[model samples]
Target chain A: EPEVTQTPSHQVTQMGQEVILRCVPISNHLYFYWYRQILGQKVEFLVSFYNNEISEKSEIFDDQFSVERPDGSNFTLKIRSTKLEDSAMYFCASTPDEKLFFGSGTQLSVL
Target chain B: GIQVEQSPPDLILQEGANSTLRCNFSDSVNNLQWFHQNPWGQLINLFYIPSGTKQNGRLSATTVATERYSLLYISSSQTTDSGVYFCAVASDSWGKLQFGAGTQVVVTP
Candidate 1:
């Protein structure tokens, strides 16, 4: 099965430093998404991307956050100046149709 | 925005037992899916039943889109089936999927 691959299974950063999470979605998939889950909380939608642009974003995705399909395969989420509350398990997903295929996720920890 | 409600926040079952999990949404949905998040936090896609029924091994799912509900049935449960089951929906305005709090299940031998 084709899978979405996220780099750096775990990351730790200082509260004020910048952090970028990278993902390589399935080759044939048309839609890509980023979601997060705070410890013990529900998974929350962050943003969706298609046609090399952002299709939609949630309130949690504010000015500090940005997503890019920098290359044909690499989709990335950059957080300018991370905050303690930004710590969570971030998931990258892709879909050829309506069914979603999720990655193992990257655990972001801000000190 | 649509509200998703999953029944019985917690469930426990013994091996060889069968169980059913329910997901109810506040509005009509074009897309609905059920995911199993293991203790390690990996979200496994179990089923994408927007409507009708589909069976995969010991698991099966049915979605009555008109009734705004979906049910996941697990037969002959095992320890490997222990995890948190989440139901999510994709609404019109937001193409991004929104997830419910999830139902935690603990299957023991």
Candidate 2:
């Protein structure tokens, strides 16, 4: 079974530093998304990308955050300046249509 | 924006016991899915039932889209089933999913 693969299973960064989380979505999926779950909280959608452009984003996905599908295979989420509150498990998902599949997730920790 | 609510914030089941989980949404949805977040923080897809019913092994799910609610049934539970089960819904074909707080399950053997 093909699955979304995310790199850097765990990332540790200092507050105000930059971090980029990478993902390789299922080969033929058309829609891609980034979601985060704060410790002990529900998962929250951050942003969605399609056709190499952002389709929708939540308020939590503010200017500090950006996503890119550079090279058509790798999807990356960059946070320009991390904060302590950014410590959470970030998930990457892709869907051919209605059934969405999620990656193992990248745990980001900002000190 | 749609609201999703899950019942019984937490549940504890002994091995071989059966349990049911419920999820309610505020409005109509085009897509509904269930996920299990394990202790390792991996979100595992369990079901994608927007309507009707489907069964896989000892697990099954039913969604009444008109009533804006869904149910997940787990039979003969095991310790591996201990995790947080999340229900997510999307109003549009490719919209972002709205996830509920999730029901934490602890299946003790």
Q: Model 1's CAPRI class?
A: medium
In terms of lDDT, the poorest run of 10 residues in model 1 chain A is A49-58
| Top of the candidates by lDDT | 2
lDDT of each: 0.93, 0.96
* TM-score: model 1 vs. ground truth: 0.98
Error of 2 at B77 (Å): 0.5
Candidate 2 lDDT: 0.96
Off by over 4 Å in 2: none
| A27-109 per-residue lDDT for model 1 (tens digits) | 99999999999999999999999898898889999999999998899999999999999999999999988899999999999
Separate DockQ for every predicted complex: 0.70, 0.91
CA RMSD, predictions in order: 1.2, 0.7
lDDT of 2 by residue, A18-77 (tens): 999999999999999999999999999999999999999999999999999989799999
Instruction: Give the per-residue Cα lDDT of candidate 2 at A10.
Output: 96
